[model samples]
Target: MRRMDTKTTTEKTGETGDNAESPEGAGSAGADIAAKTTEPVEAAEAAPAVEPLDADALGPADEVDKDDDEDDDEALFPDEAPASASAGIGGAAAAVVSAALGVVALTGTWTGKVVAERETLIGQIKTSGSGTPAQQISEIYADAWHSVALVNGVLSLVALLVAVLVLALPGRPSWVRAVAVAGAVLGGLGLLLSVGTYFDLFLNLPTAGS
Candidate 1:
């Protein structure tokens, strides 16, 4: 009986020790897990800061971009066309106008009729409506118009001759220039005579064929 009692006491003591050891091991394991979780959080909070990107740090790429922009500007604008074509057109228009005026003066009976009226050698012109009287007056004036035409032709011929001689002169003599001036004066005189004759035709002559 005594041996049996001793064995029971030993067994009881062993169970109590096992129960205490299990509780201590569970507490230590829970503490270790909590430390592991909080340690990662602390490390994350103490991490180093990251730097921000700056535009000025782009280096040679910025210069290349500026150069490209300048090249684009140069390509957009070009030089203007020259003024020679416009000047040539203006000069040609002036020449055409001069030619038109010259043609009108040449073809129209502007000078001959005027000269015919001033000459008394033709005879007195009648303003009367009598057809024969008017016809005779026009006939008389017709001769004067012809004479005026001859005078103009002769003056033009003299002018041409003087111009030729002057141009031929090696020294371009003053006398040759004087001859040209004289020819111009004579031509003016002829035109004056034509104007006077035309005035007479209107004044002394009839309005119509009569």
Candidate 2:
């Protein structure tokens, strides 16, 4: 019976020790788990502070990116000219036409008419007799000259209008501007000559055989 009691007591002691070891092991495992859980948070707190992204620091780079995008957009259409440049070319064409017409009217058509009419009047004067016939021929020649001069004056006025149109056009070329100025000068001179001839301001033609 004593041997049986000794064996029983030894089993009880082993059970108590197993229970104590299990509790210690469970507490140590819980402590390890808790440490693992909070270790990352502690490490994060101990690390260096991270700065926020600064928007102003990227401003120049963003502007460069925008400039590149704009360049790409502009390069998309390689053949088309700007609207203002096209308009300037059209204006130059108009100026050329207007100036050319003005020059021709003042120098070619009106001058030819004046020369022809003057020749006719001189012929009539040379062939007239010293009488009422001569007087009538002289009067007719004077009237005809005045009428031709008036017609020339109207033509010069038309040329002046054309010159003004040329000069007023937008973005004319240098040559076009020069032509317009020349046309204006010639038109003005033609106008003066026409007025002078019409009023007989500078001319004294022989009349009635004189």
Candidate 3:
């Protein structure tokens, strides 16, 4: 009977140990779960909040970037800018040339004088032998005068046409247009004078009999 009681007491002690160990293990497991949940919540709360971007705040920066890109493009293609400038310079030069031609037509160029002298020499050769005095006068003096008038008229016409072409073209500068207009006026006046001289309206030829 003493041995039986001792065995019973040992079984009871083992059951008590099991019960105490179960509660401690359960408490430790609950603590671990609570710690895991609280750590994640604390981490989420400590992290910085993200804000949305504003369009108005970025507008000036975008515009500045666009302007810089345009400037870079201009720098890369520098030759393109000068092409239009060269064209303008060419137009201006053409206008000046037209004006100069008009002045030369009015003032009588060396070419016109040389042409007149050549015609005079030709007339003298043709009238050397048996032409009448009237025929000689017409050949020598009238032909030479008409030749000069013809050359002047041609030069005046060229100047007038060039000026007209410049005026007709689009996008001419103010100074170019002004010069072209002056050239046209001068050419027209020169052409009129040349016509009068050619027709003997300005100066009549001397009578052969006289």
Candidate 4:
């Protein structure tokens, strides 16, 4: 009977210890699970929110790129610069031409000499048949002189008009303007001389007796 009682006491002690250990293990597992679940939730709450990017915000790099594109476009076309250069060259040429025409008028031209000769021939033919000595001299020599004067006057007038036109144009170079002024002055002088010669104001016709 004593042996049986001892065995029964030992079995009861073991069952009581097991029940206490089970409750402790269960509490530790529940605590670990709760910590793991709350860790993810706290991290989500602590993280910063993301914002959308603004479309209209341009930085310095973007502006630089835009400027480079514009410069490339100007290089590709390149029309305006050449056109202006060509216009300047044309104006300079016209100024030179006006000056040359003025000089030609002041001097004598082959065309003027040819015209004078033709007029002289015509006058001689007309007066050779019937005319006094004074009439013949007036018709032949005076007519030829007037014809040359007329040709020179026309050339001078043309030069004067061209020079005036060049002066009236805007944005001419300084050298071009100076040359044009000279051409105008020479043309005016030539025209005056031509007029005087044509009207016989410079040298009158010889008398029939002389």
Query: What is each predicted model's overall lDDT from 0 to 1?
Result: 0.55, 0.73, 0.90, 0.88
Give the C-alpha lDDT of model 1: 0.55
TM-score of 4: 0.69
**lDDT (10s digit) by residue, model 3, range 1-210:** 999999999999999889778988789999999999899899999999998999999999999999999999999997776566877888788788889988998999898899889888988999899888888889889998999899999999998998998898888899999999999998898899999999999899998777
Residue 31, model 3: Cα distance from true site in angstroms = 8.9
Q: Which pairs in model 4 have colliding backbones?
A: none
| Candidate 3 runs further than 4 Å off | 1-18, 23-67, 72-81
RMSD of each: 17.0, 7.2, 6.6, 5.8
Query: In model 4, what lDDT does residue 199 have?
Result: 98
Per-candidate TM-scores read: 0.27, 0.56, 0.71, 0.69
Off by over 4 Å in 1: 1-24, 73-210
Q: In each prediction, how many residue pairs overlap at the backbone (N, C-alpha, C within less than 3 A)?
A: 5, 0, 0, 0
lDDT of 4: 0.88
Q: How many backbone clashes does candidate 2 have?
A: 0
Prediction 2 TM-score vs. true: 0.56
| Residue ranges of candidate 4 with Cα displaced over 4 Å | 1-81
Q: How close is candidate 1 to the true structure, as a TM-score?
A: 0.27
- Collision pairs in model 2: none
